[model samples]
Structures are given as C-alpha cells and as structure tokens.
Target: MTASHGNEIMVVSGASTGIGAATARELAARGFHVLAGVRRERDGDAIRGDGVEPVILDLTRPEHVRALADRIASDPRHRPLRALVNNAAISVNAPAEVLPLDEWRRLFDVNLFGHIAITQALLPFLHRSHGRIVNISSVGGKIAMATYGAYAGAKFALEAVSDSLRRELAPHGVQVVVVEPGAVRSEMAGRGAATANDLAAMMNPEQRRRYGGLIEAVVAHSLAFTRNGLPSARAGAVIADAATVRRPRTRYTVGRDAALLTRLARFLPDRVLDRIAAANLRPYLPRQGT
Candidate 1:
C-alpha cells in the first residue's frame, strides 16, 4: 500500500478480477488497508499484495457477509471504513421468450440480493463510521436490451435499490453512490458470450433456423465491444474518488463511453434508441439453409 490517511480503510466485494480487482489495487496503492472480498480463496491469494487483506466473502452467503461485518465492527483501528464497493455481479444473455427462470433468479441472486445482503450486514459498521457505499450498477440498468433481459432486469432493480438506499442513508451521515459503467475491458463479456452460446445450443432446430444465430451473433458483437472497452483502472479511479470525496453525488458514470452512452440514451427518444440497437444487431440473422 502507498499511504492513505491513518483513519482510512476500505472494503471491496468481487475483488477477484476486473474492475473490482483494479479498485482493490488502487485503494491499496493509496495507502488504505483494503479488505478485498472474493468468493474463492485462490482469487483472494492472487490479489493479496499491497496491503490488501483478502477475505473470503461470497455475498450470496449470509454467513460470510455476517462474518465480514463482525470483523469490521470489532476492528481496533477504530478508523471508519472509508468505503464499501459492491462490484460483484453476473451478466447473462438469453432470449426472453425461452430464457430459463432459474437463470433469471440466479442473476438476481448475485447481482441484486447479494448486494442487499452485504449492505444490510455492513450497515451497522457504516453507521458507526459514517462511511460510503458504492454499488456498481450498469448502463443496462437505465435501458433494457433485447437478449440481455435477465441481466438488465437485475441491474434495473439494483438501481432502484441503490437510489433509495442513498436517500435513506444520507440522513445518517453515510454516503451511497451508484456507478453505471457502460462497457469495460472485463471478463464479464466472455461470461455473457458463454451464456449466449448456451442459450443458442438449447434452441430447437427450427428456433435456431429463425432466431438462434442472430442472438449469438449480437451477443458476440456486443462482447467484442465490451472486451475492447475502457480499462478497469479507469473505473477504479472513479470508485476511489467517490470514497474520499467529502460530499459525493448519488451517481458516477465511469469512462468516456459510459458517459457518452448514458447521455445519448437519456436524450434520444425511446423509439429512436430501439431502432438504432435493432439496426446494429440485424446482421446476426441466419441465411436460408438446412
């Protein structure tokens, strides 16, 4: 760790990779002792350098969340937890018509409910320290896309929850901010691609003849763009800034693309945006064949 204020400490969930890992590294570099929460021990070990204490915290597990809360609450440093960054989330893409209910539920289990569990668990510590909470929502949270129904649904729900939490926590001297990243160079893209592939495989031959190829193609193209998007370090900087700012706003849209896309989505009419998306995704349609 570099050197932070003696009283500053931070916790970041989903610290295994991508934006979460970058945020942990950046915070540690700033001299804050960071509790980097990860689901797997190997991931924890991998990110253990630079004063980051890797903690096994799967947000889906209430026991782990409670343990984390207990540790923070009992810390002698007495230094308030400077921030709690909820960055652990899963993105799934499937045809809404045929998407499995279990898949939808799983998305919410990690992306929405997990965040809530961790937040509720850590509330008392935050109350004591007057710390900040940063939820890593997405641009999808604002606008729903065709094949990403499940992921979009969870993100939208999370946005509402975060907004309400911000208002409710404000009076208690705790700051809550929602970060909506558009696309970032992260593993999430590959995972989304896998989900798309799985969905394509599940379609019947006639269904594949109709829409399966198109779905895969669109998801692949989107993933390509996402894989080449902004670096995670950039988003990490925004998260770090949100943590230390004396008066942080309720939302931070990280990266140039994220900022631009959000502006376009907001200013453009719903129909216009829909048409634009449709045009871009049209090329994936299958040609007549056996």
Candidate 2:
C-alpha cells in the first residue's frame, strides 16, 4: 500500500477503460489520490502508475463491492474517501417488445443497483470527508429512443436516483452530481454492438424477420455515433470538475450533441422528435417486400 500524503482520496469505478480510465488519469494528474476500480488483474496492472491505485472490483458481485469498502476502511495509509464516481455500466440495444426481461434486469444490476450499493457502503467515508458523488448518466437519461430502451431506461432511473440522493445528502454536505454525456468515444459502444449482434444471432427466423433490420440499423448508428463522438478525456475532465469544483452544478451535460439534444427534448414536442428519430432510421429500415 502506498503511504498516505493526507491528500484526498477518490474512488472511480469501471476505471479499467473509457471515461473511467480517463477520469482516473486526469484526477491523478490533478494531484488527487485515485483508487481506480477495475474488474480484472490485467486491468489493475494496466492502470498502475502515477498516483493511481488499482483496486479489483466487479460491481455485479456484492462481495467485491463489500470487500472494496472494507479494504478502504481498514487501510491505514488511506485518507477518507472524498469522491465516488459511479462510471461502470453495461448497454443492451433491442426493441422494447423483443428485449428480454433478464437483460433489462442485468443492465440495472450493474448500472443502477450496484451503483447504489457502492454509494451506500461508502456513505460513511463520504460523510466524514464532506465529499462528492458523481454519477455518470447519459443523454439517454433525458431522452428515450427506439431500440435503446434498456440503456435509456437504466440511465433515466439513475438520473432520478441522483436527484433524490443529491437532495438527501445536501444537509450532510455530501454533493451528488449527475454527468450526462452524449455519444463519446468509449468501449461501451463496441460492447453494446457486440451484445446486440449476439442477441440478433439468437433470434429465430420469425424474430429476425420482424426485427432484424431495425436492430441492425440501431447497431450501425450506435457504432457511427461512438466513432464520431467526442473523446473520453473531455467527459473525464467534466467529471473531474464536478468532483473538485467549489460549487458544482446539479447536472453537467457533456458533448455538443448531448447539450443540443437534451435542450431540444425539453422544448420539442414528442411527436416531432419521434418523426426525426424515425427519419434517421429510415435508410436502414427493411424494404416493403424483403
């Protein structure tokens, strides 16, 4: 264990890659001691260096979450945890009707429930330090679209939870902030595409016939969105700001698309938004006969 310098410590989950990894590096660069939570030994090794301590954590597993809390609590060299970044999440893309209940539950397990569990376990440390909790949500949290039902639903719930948590923890001086990012370069899009493909492959002929083209379109759009999206580092910077700012906003919207779309969602009618979304998917829609 590294000796404590009395610098505030921050816990960033899903630090193995993407925004989480970027945030770990950014925070460490800013002179904060970062406990980067990864799921695998290899990932821990990958993130080792530059004031970043890699901790193996699997959010889906309660034991791992508990162990993390216990380890932090018992470590003599650590300062009280000053920030918690709930960045770990999984994405599943499918039409609402065909999407399995199990997959939806699994998404929530990692993105919502696991996050809540970690927050609860570490509240004592956060309270003691008068710290911050940064929840990584999405533009999907504010706007729901077809084929993204599962991911959007989870994000939506996360936003709600963050709101409640922020109000509840304010009296204790523990700030809860939501970072809503639009499409950004990250492993999530690739992983989501892979999962969608796997699910498509498992579909029966009838199922494929009914939904295959739409799924393919959604997956393709997702891939393109990530490819052209803002860098993860930008989002990481925003998250780091949310953690360290003297007076942070209730929510930080990252990326131009995220800001624009979220704003449009607030003023635009659903019927108009629906038409725009449908038009975007029109090119990929299956032919009338085929």
Candidate 3:
C-alpha cells in the first residue's frame, strides 16, 4: 500500500494476536504488502495499518478462504503472493480419552485441515512467484507430553504435511518451511489453561479421579512455561527471517527450548523422554489430598 513497499504480498493467518499479529507487523515493516487474516471486524481494525491489510478469515470456512483467494487474485497492482504463514491454532489439553471426538475434530479443523485448505487455494500464486510457505508448528510436534494428545497430534500431522509439501513443491521452486516455537507469552496460554480446566470439570467422576491431579499439573506448568517463554516479537522475527531469507532452512526453532527439546526428541529413547517430561511436570503436581 506504500510506494516504498515492494510489489509482493504476504499472508499471515490468525493475525488477531500472539505470533500471528506480530508476524504480520514484521512482514509489513519489511516492505511487503501483508494481508493479515483476523476472524473479527475489531481484530481486522486492530491490525490494519500502512502496508498491512486485514482480511476477515476463518480457515475452516471455505467462503473465507475463497474470498482471500479472490482478494489476492484481484489485487489492483497484481502483486504476486510472496508467502503464506499458516499461524492459526487452538490448544486443548486433556487425556486422549477425556477429550471428546468432537473436540479433537475441532482442533484438527483449524490446525491441520484448515492449513491444507489455505495452501491448496493459494498454491497457484506461490507457484507463479516461487514463493514460500511458512508453517507455524510447535515444540509439541516433536514430543508429545501427557494431556497433549490433541494439540501434539495436530502439530505432528502438520509437520509431516510440511515435509511432504516441501518435497512436492521443490521441483517447482516453491519453498516450505516450518518454524517451531516453544512456549510464548500470549493469550493462548491462558486459553489453553482455561480449556483444560473446563474439560476437566466436564469429566465423569471416575475420569476426574483418574486424571484430575495430572490435569492440574499440566495447567500450572503451561502457565509457568508461557510466563517465562519467548516474546512474541522475537518469535515473529525468527519467522520473518525464515520467510524472507535468501536461502532459508527447511526448519527453524524460535527459542532455545524448542531447539534443545527437538534435538532431544530426535536422539533420546522414548523412555528417556518420558522421564524427562515427568521431571519437568513434577513440581507442578498436587500434593497428597486434604
């Protein structure tokens, strides 16, 4: 939208808050016309600014996806798409069995399939410009902790999809990169804690008796993890680097935790990782009942 900006466009989903909003701003500052996708009018208004346009986007909705495609295709300047940052996600922490099937589907809708939909819709522009796809993954993708079945599962699936998509597009010059971020200070941490508590409350008495303490530990640990985690702007800068670098790596880790944990997951045996996870959560677990 500015004369100083280049004739290229970038799309960042979930631009309402957290890393999404930060990444949108980062891309805009770097001189790309960034289309920041938010789910609400106020969010769009909040994020819209010079060199950054806001699109009302809900990836799970085909109409929203189509509209975004149309918007890009109809750009008056015909700015070719330069990158698409798939960043929309929701976290639900509960035992695999405790989380109902519908909840799992809901998570997958946004985390996995929704990204697929967006990628499929915009692949043409990417192919045209030989642009890249930056998937916002998580440390959870590499290691699955207790009460992380749904969230970790979705991220793992996204990681796999990214690999396959990268291979599939490499011959055509399109790049696909995955950015795995450790805990970040954001509203997501609070929402994850609230969601875990809500699901725990809905469990049957026997279910609660079986997993109540563990759920509480996870909630407390997640809050602490987020409290001391990386800043959104820092994480966004890493993502922006991944998106714009001349020769980008296939994958990047936003924080030291993500880098170390992902490496540990690769070499350590499952039993070892299990022990490590338990050790990390032990301090948060509740003591003997009153």
Candidate 4:
C-alpha cells in the first residue's frame, strides 16, 4: 500500500547508518519529506539526498528530542509529523555475569529510554497528524543469546513499551508497529564483533580464562551470521512498509532467519535453548592467543 502522507514529514532517529539510513532513502523515494536525524554532522552530511533533510538528533539529549518535537509542532509547513521511526540503538555484547552496570545503562539510554523520550516529546505533533510509530527492535528481544545481555534487555524492554503504546495510541488513530530482524548485514555487526574482541583482550588472566573463550565464540558466531545474513536494505523496506501501510501489522518479522530463530526461541525450552546456543557459539571462541 502507498504511504498515507502526501508531502507529510517523517522524523527518523539513528539515520546515519544501517536500517535507519536505508529507511530514509526508501521513504524519500516514496515521496515523504524525510528528516534524517543523526548524532554526528559528518554522518548527517553523508546521508543528505534529494528528498532527505539531515538534522542533528542525539537521542540521549532531552533537549534534542524536545527541540525536534517543537519544530514539528510549530512548523506551518509540517506541523504534524506523519511518522517517527525509533531506530537508534547500541549493541554491546557481554555475559550478564560480567556485564558492567554502566554498559547496561548506556545500552538502555539509547535503545529504550531514549526512544521513549523522543516518542513522548513528539506525541502531540504525531497526534495532530494521526501518525504512526515504527520501532526497530531485534530478534534478540524475542530470543535470548549467549552474550548480548544488555542489548537484548533493551530491545526486550522496547518491545514491551511498543506494545503498550500501540494499544494506547489506537484510539487516537495512531499506529505503533515493531520490526524484528535477524542477522541483517550492517557495519554495526562488525563493530559488535570488534568490541567483543577488545573486551576479551581487556579481561584479566582468570577472567579471560573463565569467560574469554565463550565471549570470543559469541563474537565469531556473530561475524559469521552477519556475513551470511539478509541485507539491511531489505529490512529497511519492511520498516518503511510498517510506517506507511494503511493497516500496518502489529509486528513484522523479516529476514530469512527471523522466522526460524523466533520459532525456535518460542518452542524450545529455556534450558534446551541455552544448550543449543552454547553449542552454536562455542566454535567461535578465540583460539589460544597467538
């Protein structure tokens, strides 16, 4: 279905890369006036295009979210935002047993709380336009992995919040939908692998001996899956569809592995799943230090 907006404006957070960047492109191609909200000016400049407007939007800053809301609320040309895509997120891989509290907070700050803040600030403008909210969650939200403790926790929280918001906004003619993707190809995946490698390197001798192997395995497995995963652009199209469909679904599960992973997660017992995950991730453990 075609997007409901005819020259309507869309604000997309985390548009610098991955699904956000691709979504921005897709929306612009579809005739929506797109605002590509990014944290860095360089990232923004790299993304500016024929129909895309790049804006500095760091989700962690309350003022940024508020200012953006105000802009949409007051702009005579585009007072009401037609859609808001809460796609900004950070992925940190570490076992919960060793994961730092600050790491968890940092993950939630951008992934869960930040999105909530931006959404709340923009609700008035969205309400005026009868707009939609598209949340870019992950397969981790629905399924627990071996080493993505904090990232998965944030995504899981986002899923819960999105569900509540969807129910609350339905009466106002607003739609909220969740997009869960599995192993999409993106630079973020590579960064996550690299981060894991660094973390493993930083561990003390005992710590490294106790958990380093498992951590490295997680990183390696992630790199392998990402190398073989669906393209980020494919996932972006699903997100764009979520934003514009007349009767958008409550959730859209994309990528070849999404269905399989979600089904396995749902049916397999927790202990059984854990065993499977351990086995799958074990092979990637860093080989003995060179």
CA error at residue 20 for candidate 4, angstroms: 0.7
Candidate 3 lDDT by residue in tens digits, 53-135: 99999999999999999999999999999999999999999998799999999999999999999999999999999999999
Model 1 — which ten-residue stretch has the worst lDDT? Answer: 1-10
lDDT head-to-head 1 vs 4, winner: 4
User: How much lDDT does candidate 1 score?
Assistant: 0.84
**Per-candidate TM-score against the hidden true structure:** 0.93, 0.95, 0.98, 0.94
lDDT of each: 0.84, 0.89, 0.94, 0.85
Candidate 1 per-residue lDDT over residues 1-290, each given as its tens digit: 12466566799999999999999998888888899998888998899996688999988888899889888877787766778899999878877877788888888999999999988888887888788899998888887778878888898899999989988998998888989987789888887788788888898888777767668667767876787788999888888887777777788997776787778888999999899777767776556577
Report the C-alpha displacement of residue 35, candidate 2, in angstroms.
0.9
| Model 4 spans > 4 angstroms off | 1-6, 286-290
Summarize candidate 4's per-residue lDDT along 86-189 as a digit string, tens digits: 99887789877677788789889999999999998888778887999999999999887877878888998999999999999999988899999898888888
Give the poorly placed runs of model 3, Cα more than 4 Å off.
1-5
Q: Write candidate 2's Cα lDDT for 1-290 as tens digits.
A: 12233377889999999999999988898888898999999999999988799998888888998998997798777677888999999899987777789999999899899999999999999999898999999999988878888889889999999999999999989999999999899999999999999999888899898889999888888888889998999999999898888888999999999999999899999999999888878876666785
